[model samples]
Target: MKIILISLITLVSLVSCSNNSQVVSPKLDPLNQQFISEDELFRLVLHMDKLDYRSDEKIQLHSTLEYIGTEKKATIWHGMPYINYLITDGKDFSVGGVVSTILKSTTLEKGEVYTFPYIKTGAFSENDPNADFWREFFDEKDLYLPPGRYTLTVYCGFSLTEDVVNSKYNNKVEVEITVD
Candidate 1:
């Protein structure tokens, strides 16, 4: 009787464990950002937000115009770093998943510039535990504006990223940027 009882208990435990199933989102891990090389070319990256999206297709590309400090934590502390920002189709594809950002920025001594490449793919699941770095940046932002021209204007209107910003976005200067 003891042996039979033990077998029954084990079978019940296995059945209970087998019945558990859940869907979870992946996490957006941060990228290991570094200088790809010395002569890397950088262009201006603009996020598609706060304006008329003149394009019919979704997904716009953008870059962050960051202000650099002499002794900041996230920078080499030489000059301002302009990062490539992307305003993806996240809004229309809410049912879709998170997008990862592999942004890179380098500053030239005489030019005001920033650039990054955007590869818009599926979104990440919060429960996915193994989402990539770019995915983390993608999952953080809840809103993705339509295709249009806009400005950085102080890391989204506040000084949250000021330590990483160089004296550019604070003026709320909206330059003419277009998306297709």
Candidate 2:
């Protein structure tokens, strides 16, 4: 009887431990403006005002990083622009901005959130081969996306510490949009 009781307690403990280690899926906002990706230490959310737009409309994009680990605080080391955006038509058209090479760090406590916005400067040179195509798609005066479907991916490139790891993390979330 004593042996049976000990076995049952051990089995119950094992089951509870396994349950605690199970992966949890990221939750989404009801309105769909926020798309989420997560890991054991953090949660990244990509935010777009809407999923549909006109050919001449200006799209606003940003991302947020939230510390979700059990630790009191976590430090992330990355480039000047920790988070960046990549917009692609999945064919011939793609647009992304250059990021500064300067290193930076940010620390966050559990449940704290940090925001990063998409920013671009300068325009394509007129002498470039794709100058005409780029002019039609965007200009220095205003930014617009041509009429088509696009996949916008927001990625946060960082490492847990300043020390070089075997591989750094580029956590990203992709969402599709349409322009009439």
Candidate 3:
């Protein structure tokens, strides 16, 4: 009887230990997705909140630059808007803008990440030339585009050091999304 009790205790202890040793993985966010591009010195990741959106719903877009080089730290010099976007639907209709000529600089350590400013979407005025045509499909505030598939291309332009006149790097990544 003593032997039987000892065996039962050992089995229970083993089961409890096994349960405690199990590792639970983290759940991924469905709304947030990433498209990535990498080079010898940097890894650029483009983040989109969702792949599909309603005609009235707004879209979210952003990007991150990670220092993947073997150096202790790296400096990036660029203009006011270091990141730019070009969105198109494989047709004549496209959306983009120009950035200011003001210069700026940013530093990052090894394995460190730098997040750029968020990309704004759907900010059109009723006085736009195509406002009347787009009004049939989208609301005034959501006049970026109609419901369809689009390819969003992000450009990360910078130089390694303060000498912007010399070498420059332009990292580009693209992500596809659908607007219902």
Candidate 4:
């Protein structure tokens, strides 16, 4: 009985030591806006550089599209890449234009990461029919964000669909951002 007890104590100590040394990654936000398609072929991860921002400051964000399936997948997008943002209170800041060509597709292999250029968030507007404020050229006009909390949604895709102005993205990631 004495020998058995000593062995048990030694095993428990080893287990405890291993558990203490185990590495754990930080948990992502519940609303960080990660989505996997119904088929599980692709995963979309969307997040902003920071959770809070000063008024009129440029809010930077990134969208990463990863192919998770065993086989390579190709998807079509017609025009330049853009993110669709819809705030919680029913305000939106989005833009889309005509695609000169037809059927632009991007192919990705398993475990591949497709990186997009850092995109800056736009000001919220309900009456800007043109949605021109989302454009980078109009930086002078982008200083219109008010002090409040807003939901920053990012839909990853080419902005060249009939529902570009109205339809939300099938694969989207979102994050809650604040303006102070």
Candidate 5:
């Protein structure tokens, strides 16, 4: 009787363990940030709430633009200042996402800083133009990034003149993150 009871208990435990199946997202490694540019006309600072994340987790990124000039400067530009991210895996690069910022033309006072709200990486349009015609081809799933080491370089704004962007004032911040 003792032997039979032990066999039955072991079988029950095995069946119960096998029934416990749950879907869990992959875990990510810690994030790393690198600042490349030193031009002080406008400074871009990046902040992430947590360094590590899972594939299903939302990567919350906050960026701020501070006017570091001594006096007020006329910041003239075309459209609203937008964000572009270049993500790479040491081999190839992917246009991670783009935030289509819609802001009216404005000037920045000395020492004034503009902080943008946290932009969730999971819910961004992957460089989509957001036109009414091409809406059908884009979806949130298309932007799903797998677990890997990614270096994300963010360009804050485009230069007023194409030549200046190539030669001077290309404000940007680069950060490295691991998504597992």
Candidate 6:
């Protein structure tokens, strides 16, 4: 009995010592909007390494879109890429499943434009929107506001490897934007 108790204690100590540290840091908002503030024509570029594509098909990196129409429209749009979306109620936010995009083997820059196109879930009608904002992905549309200051969050997972399928990565960003 004494030997068994000693062995049990030793096993417990070994288990405690092997914590298997998994450092999950809080997400950092690093949106590179150094030049344009409100209604300026600009583009967005997102980087992806093959592993981030959780889709049934192999995801692609390096894509573009004509999001910024003109300097006065205050319009930016991208097709949904992920499954999480959020709606804001002043201070807090309402979360939902929405459209989001994934990238692999790519880099984002100021001069790049990314476009995502989606049809609104409801039936097509004069009163229907061409696309669903938060219903698809977490973009500006889900926030639902008139014109004010707000913060936008994007969650990205990444992985880079000689065989991208074997690498691992996570990338997310938040942006300070104005409604108009």
Q: Quick one: best lDDT, which candidate?
A: 2
Q: Give the TM-score of candidate 5.
A: 0.53
Error of 4 at 123 (Å): 12
Candidate 4 Cα errors over 4 Å, as ranges = 1-39, 75-77, 82-89, 92-102, 118-137, 140-144, 158-169
Candidate 3, pairs of clashing residues: none
RMSD of 5: 19.8
Candidate 1: TM-score?
0.24
Per-residue C-alpha lDDT of model 5 across residues 24-104, encoded as one tens digit per residue: 113322235424344557776665555456877766655556667655674534223344455667873354444223222
Residue 102's lDDT in candidate 4: 29
| Model 1 lDDT at residue 44 | 25
**Cα lDDT for residue 13, model 5?**
53
Q: After superposition, how far is residue 47 of candidate 6 from its true place, in Å?
A: 14
**Which candidate number maximizes TM-score?**
2
The residue-by-residue lDDT of candidate 1 on 1-180, one tens digit each, is 554456445544543354222111132222322212121222222344334444554334333333343333222221112221223332332222121111223323324333333333233443445445435545544434335443322112222233535533332223443444
Distance from true location, Cα of 178 in model 5, Å: 0.6
The 0-to-1 C-alpha lDDT of every candidate, in the order given, reads 0.32, 0.69, 0.65, 0.48, 0.49, 0.32
Ranking by TM-score: 2, 3, 5, 4, 6, 1
Question: What is the C-alpha lDDT profile of model 3 across 6-85, one tens digit per residue?
Answer: 64465445434543221112332324788899988889887777778886776766677778998989878875456677
**Model 2: runs farther than 4 Å from truth?**
1-32, 121-125, 132-143, 165-167
Residue 4 C-alpha lDDT in model 1? 41
User: If both were scored by lDDT, which would come out higher, candidate 2 or candidate 6?
Assistant: 2
lDDT of 2: 0.69
For residue 87, what is the lDDT in candidate 2?
82
Cα lDDT of model 2 by residue, 10-97, tens digit: 5445434543221122443334488999999889988777999998788776677888998999887765456777788999668764
For candidate 1, which ten residues in a row score worst on lDDT?
75-84
| Cα-based lDDT at residue 100, candidate 4 | 24
